[model samples]
Target: MGKIKVTQVRSNIKRPQDQKRTLEALGLNGIGQEVEHEATPSILGMVKKVEHLVSVEEA
Candidate 1:
């Protein structure tokens, strides 16, 4: 699978617990933090859940 870069673009404060957990799961601790992961179905699903808080791009 291709690798994708996921960047936390927004704060998780005031967000739902699940969303916060999703960000943590993606290895993001704060805004501007970026993590690279394989573009697998599971990761894509997780990204979709918190799409508003992060930006995804080709790695």
Candidate 2:
């Protein structure tokens, strides 16, 4: 499978609890932090939930 780059582009403050947890689930702890994950359904779903808060790139 291919890998995806997930970067936190925005702050999680004032966001929903679920969105905060979703960001954490993707390994983003702060603005500008990044993590590489598999391009799987589960991860994609998480990314969709917080799409506005993150930037995704194929890696």
Candidate 3:
């Protein structure tokens, strides 16, 4: 399987609570935080939740 890299590119300020939770759940505590996660439906859903606050790339 391929790895997916999730990076927090934008600030979470003023964002929805759920999106903040998604970022935290993904191990993103602050802006510029990046984490590697397996490409799965659940992770994809989390990514979608905070897509505007983050950037994703294949790793």
Superposed on all Cα atoms, model 1 deviates from the true structure by an RMSD in Å of 0.4
User: Model 3, residue 22: what's the lDDT?
Assistant: 88
lDDT pick, better of 2 and 3: 2
Candidates in order have lDDT scores of 0.96, 0.96, 0.92
Tens-digit lDDT track for model 1 on 1-59? Answer: 99999999989999999999989999999999999999999999999999999999999
lDDT of 1 at 16: 98
Clashing pairs in 2: none
Candidate 2: tens digits of C-alpha lDDT, residues 1-59: 79999999999999999999999888999999999999999999999999999999999
Query: Against the correct fold, how does model 1 do in TM-score?
Result: 0.97
Deviation of model 3 at 59, angstroms: 0.8
Q: What is the TM-score of each candidate against the true structure?
A: 0.97, 0.97, 0.93
**Candidate 3 — what's its lDDT?**
0.92
> What's the distance in Å from true for residue 5, model 1?
0.1
Candidate 2: misplaced stretches above 4 Å?
none
